[model samples]
Target: MLSRPSGGAVMKYGFPSLSNIRTRESYVSSYDPRTRTPAWVIERLGGDTLGGNADRKRCDFKEDDRSDACVRECAGVSVCVCVCARVRAACTQVSACVRPCSVHVFHRATNGDYRGSGLDRGHMAAAANHKWSQKAMDDTFYLTNVAPQNPHMNQNAWNNLEKLCRSLTKLYANVYVCTGPLYLPRQEADGKLYVHYQVLGTNHIAVPTHFFKVLVLERDGRQGGVELRSYVLPNEPVDEKIPLERFLVPIETIERASGLLFLPNIVRTSGGAVTAAANK
Candidate 1:
């Protein structure tokens, strides 16, 4: 069994197990040694979503040198999830050294993947949220934890949402955050909405049309009931003036779209709620 953090009741966070996933296509879960918990799980998909070449790639390194290199199964990263908590110390500045995964090749994003691609190497597990330790924050930089994200969306609205998660720590004992990419539908000239998104790099990394953040707050200490909040933001540039509540959607919406289940052990009565104060 995994050891729980000291000084608090054991609270569950991060991606649930594969048994909990209803849709099993292109999904894998792994435990992160640094965080001592489930690092992140992803639902890999092809470039067109019609199922073409979305499979993982094998490591090209030799046997003797293979230990330090990314393995064959790390290529097709679609979405990633990680539990986030606020740290007591001020957030540190770490150089953005985006590297490929040594264990799972398709599971991680490469530094060259985002080069000249216009999209930012957006972190599914925002580094600032894990300032509790250098390793915790460093683990978040792994390519598997990132997806191609619009710079406007990542820097502005998405950044705001990250801040909101950090702020909740002041009110709750810990904040459980699950972030991932979404491929949503859009209406076209024919008035029909179709699910479409771009793929980046030779590995065909899927660029999500939108992103989601699901926050579970452990209020009144870990013993108290939890509060849930889920938000879905477009991958495009969002107006900075728009309130974060505008992106709020029922958790059911995310479950249906992402094929991932959350907060199954906890009792949830209604959709999660978010206040404007959280934006500040």
Candidate 2:
């Protein structure tokens, strides 16, 4: 039998950064307020967590309602109002109506930002991985868990990568997948490397230059061990015909590029035959 790890435990692994940590039903993530996207998201996938009566059609991409804008009123006077990026204009109107309107703003991307931005709201945590429960699937739709992605990339090659993660569940007893974005530097004409990317909407949601997925496959039964695989793809259209193995990269490469450490946690938690074909 598979030794079950907590579904979405905070202590399960070392996160890239400790800022703005949030846990959902199926995944644990760290939000980057500056970029308005998740720094990283980790989810556990097993046979039991694969299928259920969950309907994706019922789910919609939305702001993190758990921490939405709020206004505090004391003695029939509005004391403070914290507004989201999308409703800053409305907050201005409220401020005008109140004598001591103190407005503080929190940054979060909204659906309207992506409405005509020509970029898809790519999911850091794939929705299909949390089909075991509707709530789990719904959690994946939160805007905080998404980043700007090329439409073609999101629907084609990127989709294939997500499928590969699910397929691994059949081979291993469990699969722990960590997905996130990377801002790689490029050489400029002046012989210096620079990092640049587009920002969408009024919130200035950053579009990652590339994305990464690192998988930890747990071996089943008496012979307990784990295997590691990591892959990175650009945030643009890629030919679907290319084999995924071509995108396979060493775990350390992802660690350096995305500022995330995975091997240490794997060694600490699963003390056994840990091997990685990707590094070979």
Candidate 3:
């Protein structure tokens, strides 16, 4: 059972569970808005790591605080990662408009960034996952959390994957998710695939060729072990009819491509027992 800090009530299966260790990354921001130096970063709040701690640090959102969700803004890349816990009871349908984060100028994205680009304002941290509160839901509308994604892929395959994440709340005590962009390699006429991607606007906002989602699920009971799932999807239009199972990939694959680690402590606790399902 997972216990809520606010209510102090034990729930059989909770939406956001505690993590054994912090999962935020430390990097150098090359942008000029804030001090361009090395710093620790946390994208949003409401995940397994709620408050600021020694290991996990939070970013300053300057003026665009929504008071509902947390944000980790990468001014250098002009993209932000959003984190939140999905509670079925607090989930509400709310219509919100997309806007810019008024914080450190280049730290976030803007509407003009995607103006003529043949791409959708892809969300790194999905909006629907935060249906628990209208403010949390609206917090997702910030341009900083979006990337230039192929319209078809964003609306179809990616949407299905988000739905699957939400469904896991019913089976696990807590579900912690980390979503981000990937600039991967692609094959050309010569058959040699090269790593390359595009950027948009004056800020040079990166348009990832692929996106990744890493999910950590804690079982409902004391003996329930941790499970890790990772996926990488192309930024192109995918056939909606394709089964989502086709995208299941090994966590190592993501770690290798993104240069980030997920659930490092839990991975050691399970003795590396978390195996990737064979992509069928």
Candidate 4:
């Protein structure tokens, strides 16, 4: 388990897992070592938190290797080894450097892995939502906060969805977004349900078959009223013409699919009734 951060505002409603939790400048994430991706990422958004000169163009996706050594090591390893250099006087110079390096290794997805994979490094906690600071925007680029997403969907539908989240700040006082990946089981021709997804690169980062985002929208204030809207989108290309509301699903559906609970009771305790979007 990683140490919790100073501010608890980002995780106002609580998260799914207690293990492997990491705190960032703009968001909180639970790292999944096995998948080399975030299990879930939660962030709070509002008009104030969205205004800044942070440039996404200046940010680059990097391995989050500064946290717990175990988590960093699990991402990959860099080991210093002996190097032999030929000398001009019939003698060779040998240098032996025995040090631990964790720049890039297996069991973690590097930027190179997505180079030809036809998949985009989709952000779970969108960078645009964290324009409050450059560090915040930079943290969202961490590989742990990303997942493999279809290029078409990532650039089209998914990008639109992210824009919608940012746009919601105008209407709502506070918007808490929880996003993650889901690997749903599908029934094959043999009539057996199986969970199957592709693995990318030498690290074999598991590609999620579906992705989910749950929005906790505060009407007036934190104690005002709350409305929940949950969505699930397939990993493949989705028609950009389709309405986002078409993918709206009950919060319970997401809970069952991702094994993560969004505490509705806590939202209700904010002195307002908690309502979820009607199931479609």
Candidate 5:
């Protein structure tokens, strides 16, 4: 049932900026050596996907592979072609279809962004858990362009929520989140040094589900502030919920211990800063 709008093709999923947003034109347009670094959330790490200087790794499977997973009618007959789960092969579920993905297949996109090694199949507007909006057909939701984010958060926490939040979308459609000593492109050249996590797990998922989102402001050596702005969907956006320690505490604690809170959602107040930019 899910098909592209303009051309009536299968749809794709998306990822982040600073690790956040730009547009598809500026996104997939040819790559210039000057801007070898990716613009999307995956640029931080996953940037080295196919064209980057670094070697490819795991966690990418969920985003990179399974392009032809939709109904591909060939030879005058409608046929269902399920997408393969990984680059290698293992488990698969029709629900986990990649949409606003963060990597690329072809070496170059029509946008002119020369498909380079650092490129990723990014999704401008996430393809997963897309019931919230209907812009999938627009280039805004295209998988060729998106932002940079932690691979773990993109696939596991964020991705998990996409499926889990399906039924509960009625009660609390979206969740705003702010997790770390956030960092972004203007802030760092190579992108964040630490990995990001969506403030998920046990307690954080217990919110009443309204118009709530987490804001990640970076707090450097001198308590600077948060930076990134991202959101997560809960398994069940129960109308009756609270800030249970299950989700809140660990987030704060992780940041205090971390020295530099470049990777937002992962750190909390109790967590230490991994960077000594201020203390020194």
Candidate 6:
């Protein structure tokens, strides 16, 4: 049986039994604008409310809200990543400050044709957490929740992680990560924002993103990259700790544990850099 693997120690990921991974089945049948998402998915996804009812609290980032800080606090050190990256491991190259992040919105804003592909609203903070209410759940539908992630990566990564940890775990039992603000801000200088993740497994980092990033790159060195340290939330529950990179490891380790060969990204080799709007 496949078991949980953590830390820098690598596990051999042989091909998983085909039956193990369930095929994606639509949760709802007819589309109801009232319930943007199906009821089954909400229950399965661990949302507090079902039917998209505007019952519970939604993050009020709209006004003088501390939602941003709350999100950062909840994510805590990096959470164990179950998201599998076929093109090696990866993270949202999408920046936090980018404008009209929604590809649809951006297309409209630019007077350009809207492309079929879109951004993945990854909650740098997870959606299941208490921080997410019905409204929060619906709001997440906005492109803002999505960072420009390859559709395949977001689905596989979060889906697998959820299955492995039972319910999207938010702590580093085997692997630990710490993420926070950069001391000497360098937002504009590098063009790439810096967020540090400490993987207790490796006790070091080799990539710019979190646990998954360092593990996926299969390389070492922070030359063109930037780094930031995490702020410790005093007396926070262990379960709520953020999933930052506690330590860095090789992709082979992830491969062994996952039993997958995650192919490399085709565009990455062809010098295909993603063109994004400048940071606002």
Which 10 consecutive positions of candidate 6 have the poorest summed lDDT?
22-31
Instruction: Report the Cα lDDT for candidate 2.
Output: 0.74
lDDT accuracy of residue 232 in candidate 5: 27
CA error at residue 160 for candidate 3, angstroms: 0.3
Q: 80 in model 4: Cα distance from truth in Å?
A: 31
Clash count for each candidate, listed in order shown: 10, 0, 6, 1, 99, 30
- Residue 52, candidate 5: alpha-carbon lDDT: 20
Q: Which ten residues in a row have the lowest lDDT in candidate 2?
A: 95-104
Residue-level lDDT of model 6, residues 142-220, one tens digit each, is 3222222334434554434433322322221121111111112125566976544221111111111211321111111
* TM-score, every prediction: 0.65, 0.80, 0.61, 0.79, 0.25, 0.24
Instruction: Give the per-residue lDDT digits (tens) of candidate 2, residues 41-94.
Output: 888888767877779999999886422223333234432122222343345444
Residue pairs with colliding backbones in model 3 are 43-71, 43-72, 44-70, 45-70, 90-132, 91-131
**Model 3 alpha-carbon drift over 4 Å, by segment:** 1-103, 189-193, 268-280
Clashing pairs in model 4, backbone N/Cα/C closer than 3 A: 78-101
Q: What is the descending lDDT order?
A: 4, 2, 1, 3, 5, 6
Worst 10 residues of 1 by lDDT: 57-66
Name the better of 1 and 2 by TM-score. 2
Question: How would you encode candidate 5's per-residue C-alpha lDDT over 172-217 as one tens digit per residue?
Answer: 2222222222221123466655533332222111111111122332
List runs of model 5 lying over 4 Å from the truth: 1-119, 131-137, 143-145, 148-153, 164-170, 173-280
Error of 4 at 181 (Å): 0.3
The order by descending TM-score is: 2, 4, 1, 3, 5, 6
Q: On residues 246-272, what C-alpha lDDT tens digit does candidate 3 reach at each position? A: 787877787677666555345233322
The lDDT leader among the candidates is 4
lDDT of 4 by residue, 113-156 (tens): 78889899999999888777888889889898899999999999
Could you tell me which residue pairs clash in candidate 2? none
Give me candidate 5's TM-score against the actual structure: 0.25
Supply candidate 3's per-residue lDDT for 126. Answer: 64
Can you give the lDDT of residue 59 in candidate 1? 15
